[model samples]
Target: MRHIVIRNLGPLAEADVFLNKINIIVGPQSAGKSCLLKTACFCNWVEKRIQLSQDTDAFKENGVFENKFLEFHKLYGYVKEDSYIEYENDSMKFSYSWKTKVFDFSWKEEGRWNYVCPKISYIPAERNIVAAIPNWFEVSMKNDNIRNFMKDWQEARSVMTEDMPILNLGVSYRYDKSNNMDKVTVGDGVVLDFTNTSSGLQSLIPLLVHLEFLYTKRFNTEQSKNILRIEEEGTLISIIWNYAKNKSHGEFNIEKVYSNFTEMKRTEVFLEEPEQNLFPPTQGVLAYRLMDWARGEKGGFLFVATHSPYMVTSFLEKDNENDISLFFNKESKDGRYVVSTATEKEVQELYDYSIDLFHNLESLG
Candidate 1:
């Protein structure tokens, strides 16, 4: 998918950075890279196609009827004090056009308006995995709709015990005897804890679970449409159970393929700076693995807003085409910020500089 254009965005007076599958937004601090990612997240929220919602009371109490509003608002830099959003779509060609109006404090003065929203996930630069992990979990939980929609899983709950060590280690929800209610855990050696894991583990756990749940949910739902009973020989449950149980160690590791979605996920995962807590080597590894998974898993797209040259170089080394789009924001004479793209040669040069800097740092160590 291509960005096509973005107008009247934060500090971005008017800029257009066309996008590809693996698009990269690189720029100095406060260059509107995060702004672009937010715009894509907002678009995805509004589109309603990607089901990311919450089943919590805070959402209902706020009168936030849909999850899109919440997800759209999570993106910083968009003038949220008072804003109006509008957009259009052309499904035949799989393209969209969107506009959001950011009103100033007075509501009368126009802050900024952005056009073009894509199905993007924006991982911020600072990483802030601790704070971000919960939000990701919320999104994943809502999308999985496991709590509300997956009746089979709900029924199977009785057959399964919440006491399992692995179940407690992974992120999930459980019931409390004292309150007779459910609680979410973050895999910290039982005790229904979410704080013991490292920030990296916490952040990645939700993403992994979400992907697994999404594929599982879709496969079950679709298979049920075609099959009737639980046949011992060839049934949906057996198929998914075998598939999930047989997943391998690699990045894209499913033993048996159930549906087309499994073939090519094509999900546009937006990450701001995935290398927040990771060292240079680990950073490159994570970025490479995630991108490779997207390409191989049919999980189509990945849009990243990053300052780490190591991550960008990792993508470049993979020999993917214009898949990585670069953006740089410049201030105009009038004190306005404008976003622009870096040429292929410019990006490569920047990568080289980053590599040299990292190598020098390594030498110092």
Candidate 2:
């Protein structure tokens, strides 16, 4: 399990959450659910770069750090004077301070967690936009998060061998490589272009496709190298050259360092609003599938930020409830948003609240 503590960051006044095999954060709008997930994703990305020997210089260059880390994720504006964070997994510990704009990392060299690198992907809320526009790359966009997701969606399409059923919702998604477009198959062989699919299909297909692609290519060294950003190639070459120099002096093995760069043993995906445009029953099914996906492989992990109570309640219905960790981001008595462990009682309260609102609507008539 991974643990994180955050304070005074964006709408999150304070939060302490554990990242388990299946972690879900539910909260109201602007309550900082996305902020917390993005923070964790950024820290994990930094940890991977540090493992590749790319951190020493960036730590000194705060501007580079901000541009690459915060700005890339569109989280630059979330920092406050009192903002602070600490994240620790089995192998790495990371902390950051907003006042100094500094990041500190501690790597455990001798442990089971050592050399355990995860390929992290952030599926943004705008993923449906990519599905709607096949040639999205042609359009210029400032949001790196969505642009990166579009790239992933494109790559995922290349690897699709057959149509994918969307949660058994009586529709299947497929990619037409030759035509360079997406297609959906409905009952009785009716075919619809992906652009013409329902809002729910559009929203869910990108996420599922990306997950399938990553799962298929897990532990693939070439695939891992292919995904590396072009700017990071300089650091990658530098690390290899330094290793070669050390090898000449009998200090280290160059082959081992090279292996570290190529081998990615895990896949950690941070999903924003996974339940978007999904029905309650389908959301329940998706939640179970996500759990199975994370627990099926040794190093697979999922971190989801959602507003749907169905997604959270599904875990309670499962026998392996202990495997999932639920966090609720809500306003405290002081009117600051805080994250706390989600309980069955709280889920019931959500239902009660919804019922009350529905009653209020009925009374209005």
Candidate with the greatest TM-score versus the true structure:
2
Can you give the lDDT of residue 197 in candidate 1? 51
Worst 10-residue lDDT window for candidate 1 reads 104-113
Question: Which digits, one per residue and each the tens of the lDDT, describe model 2 over residues 198-254?
Answer: 899899988888887787654552653444555565667676676466445655555
* Candidate 2 worst ten-residue window by lDDT: 356-365
TM-score of each: 0.53, 0.83
Please count the clashing residue pairs in each candidate, in the order shown. 14, 0
Per-residue lDDT for 118 in model 1?
Answer: 23
lDDT of all predictions, in order shown?
Answer: 0.46, 0.74
Q: What is the lDDT of residue 8 in candidate 2?
A: 90
Tell me, by lDDT, which candidate is best.
2
Model 1 RMSD, rounded to 1 decimal: 13.9
Residue pairs in candidate 2 whose N, alpha carbon or C atoms collide under 3 angstroms: none
What lDDT tens digits, residue by residue, belong to model 1 across residues 73-191?
A: 34334543323333333321112222222211111112111112222343433333323333433443333222222232232222222532222235463334554332345535345
